[model samples]
Target: MNKRLVVLLGMSLVSSAAFAQSSVTLYGIIDDGLTWTSNQGGKSAVQMQGSISQGNRWGLKGAEDLGGGTSAIFRLENGFNVNTGTLSQGGRLFGRLAYVGLSNDHYGTFTLGRQGEAVGDYIGALSANGTLPGGILFPHPGDLDNNGIDFRLNNAVKYVSPTIAGLTGVAMYSFGGVPGDFNKNSAKSFALQYVGGSLQLVGAYTSIDHPATAVPEGVWTPNNTVNGNYGLAASSYKVLALAAAYTIGSARFTADWTHTQFGGLDPTLGAKINGHVTFNIAELVASYMVTPTLQLGAAYSYTQGNVSATGKSPHYNEVDASVDYLLSRATDVYASATYMRAGGGAVADLAPVLSPSSSQNQLALRLGIRKRF
Candidate 1:
């Protein structure tokens, strides 16, 4: 019975049977930067962008308790690419999240397998590519509506609740285990949140089916079209979101809104017509904390799209800023800038996940650093 002594005898039988309620942890984050792309292919470069602001990861989380208050949780996250170290959401090996659940601080929580949704968890952290210096080059233009940060979901099932009096709720479903194709690459989502006091609110909804055959598993084939991968390859994809935030004293204010839909549409991948395609987005963000280690942020986003049988519309407008600082308590340092414009007169192309900008305006700048554990 080897194999590292059967994993150290199963970790000493789980540390003597939850020796004082279990817990396991190991976390990570490491970001890098040195960007400046005012047109990479068209010339104007300065690379070394790894994990934009957050993306490189590491994980293993656990919980046990299982007593009156309930507990039994698990997580396994991993997403990498700290500049060539390799692996990142499209590379699996615990591509960002993997779950197992049971939680109850008065009844709530239930999970199982790959997650993240509910508008990137209750309104994508008030937007700005889901917070923290707007990483991944700031989405919107093809983030379609993951509201907070790019994709995730695979054969799932989730629920969250508990936080009454200030509200909270969530739900999810995912599956496309394929095999007779029950809704091809299925997915679903729902969310709601509120937090009184300094005020905060959220709302969410999502849908996906055949999102390029539902990504997952090293993400690379099929392409998940709709703009970057080239439009018109949607058999379904939907999203909706609403958000709000407030705080006075060191400042904070936010607003987010989203709407996306792209059903049917497969005009062989590039169409002048064939059906459905819609998008709408709005965002406003702000952050301030002059001292206390510095901090500053700003954002503005707007997107609009349409093609319902070719009424033709394409839009863009983005703005960003950041100044972060705080080189302690987990470290950080930043500087950012982003800009986009592509108003009217567009047959399609705003990309936004980088690349694209032969002229409707595009600019980016960054100076970054990060570390966490």
Candidate 2:
């Protein structure tokens, strides 16, 4: 009996030590709002909205120590609508993000599963829609350049380098998953980011083959839940983006540019010829902290698109302004106004809900609250 008691105590100590090396956490955010739009398919509209500042999400994350400054990590995140209690991302349970990875303090991190591309991960926050002053309505026309967190890559593998001299690098690739065609639906992306004091710079590039087939539920799909049928089908899609941000006292300024191309358009897009369409977009944003709990911000952006076959150029100009007040460490309330004007025979469109306007201008306003846990 004495020997058995000693053995049981030893086993209990080992189990406790192992348990101490592993941890799991639950986290989430909720955002809801009321919105008014100047035009939607030629009519004005008002509605209750969810995910104004950010998407509503609940997630679980865990890490297990493996000694030698290395660990295994995993995450599962879900997006939902607070209004109707339905899951976002086509009703998938863990559609927002799901990944498993290994991390090393010195060697960096490697991950696999559905994940964001480099452009949206590295440079998105420096753009208008990714900033605090902007929200779903402030994304570039149709979010053609993916400056917003609108999509993710499936069957992906990603690597993030450790910060060196205030700089970090990221690379990712997605498998086509086709039985015989290895590159038919593949995607590749790369990004670099540098942070120095109050200044930061980032750049990223992404190329996808057969985007529609690669990510059927992605933003490229016609009439997606977020953007309209702006990018229905293409043989390939590519994006290049760069951004810089600087802070001075209580003020912050940001600038960014992106180039997007839809190559080898399908007949559904009305591209009668065998050429591609391209868009060049640029933006500037500034924000100031009025008080410890209050902030104000404004931004401007311009987009130019060229149709190689028709020789037609369509353009859009947009302006945005916003104010935010903090209620507590985990909650905030905000209001925003966004307007866009279209030219060259293009209709105006706002993001996340509103449809394309019949005329050349569209405006959107929203008041919302967000809480994090």
Candidate 3:
């Protein structure tokens, strides 16, 4: 009996050691705010907004070591609204991210499921609107170029290369999942990034077929557009963007440019135009760390638009300013102000705000708190 007891105790120790090779974690963020708009459908108003600085979310992630410098990894992330307790991203349980993949030290990581495009992964890091201190209000008009990741791709297969000499590359493809048509609603994206010392650079490109059909709940949807009543129904959508950031002392500066196109529009399908439309946007951002727990940021952007069929051109200009104070490592308070002006008969609009201004100018102010765990 004594010998058998010793063997069983040894087996239990080995089992526990093996189990330590796998691990899982839960994490989330909650952000809520109050916003005052100078013009929302011709009236100045104040409202409660949730997830202004960061989207409210909870996520589970795990990894299992498989030996030989490889591991199996998975993540499931869900987005929700703090104000209404409703799910975000079209109400999908794990709409923000749902993926499983394998990571190898020597090779690269490969993943499959619904995921973000290369633009959001690579170039987004260097864009002001992609991160805190700038927040959602800093994005270009309509978020048309996806600098802040307005939508994600479904049925995607993604590859991320291991960093080599401070450079990394990423690619992704999303299948349309339409039984007979392979290209319909499909998407392809690529990105390259380099980070070294105080300077960072990135470039990304993405093309999607049938924007409205590919992402029904995304930016092209009627309710998702800047103005709730309008939608863009195009045969294809494309974006190309480049960005660079430099840090000096307690200050950082970023500059980025993006080009977006909506091609082959059908006027009968809720599209206002019979032909394509394109936009070119450029932005500059600067941020300064005033103290260990305080920061200030500002940005300016310009957008140019052209309609292929009407020979019409329009332009827009926007400015964003923000301040952040850290209450603790896991909590912070922030304030932001944004203003936009439109020219050439274009209406002033901002993303995530369902209404367009009655005039060609708009302004908004927000105060918010964010907590991460």
RMSD list, candidates in order: 18.9, 2.3, 2.0
What is the C-alpha lDDT profile of model 2 across 157-248, one tens digit per residue?
A: 99999999999999999999889999989999999999999999999999999888786665565453112223446789999999999999
lDDT of 3: 0.84
Pairs in clash, predicted candidate 3: none
- lDDT by residue (1-373, candidate 3, tens digit) is 9999999999999889868999999999998988888888899989888767877899999999989999999999999999999999988999999999999998999999999887666666666676555477667788888877778999999999999999989999999989899999999999988999999999999999998889776566544333223346788899999999999999999998999888887766667667887889998888898999999988889999887777767789999989999999999999998899988667788656437788889898989999999
Query: How many clashes does each candidate structure show, in the order listed?
Result: 0, 0, 0
Better of 1 and 3 by TM-score: 3
Model 1 ranges off by over 4 Å:
1-23, 26-60, 63-73, 76-98, 101-112, 116-132, 145-151, 157-181, 184-207, 210-235, 238-261, 265-274, 278-308, 311-322, 329-338, 345-373
Clashing pairs in 1: none
Query: Once superposed on the true structure, which residue ranges of model 2 sit more than 4 Å away at CA?
Result: 1-7, 222-232, 268-273
Best by lDDT: 2
Q: Report residue 55 deviation for candidate 2 (angstroms).
A: 1.1
Q: Residue 56 CA error for candidate 3 (Å)? A: 0.8
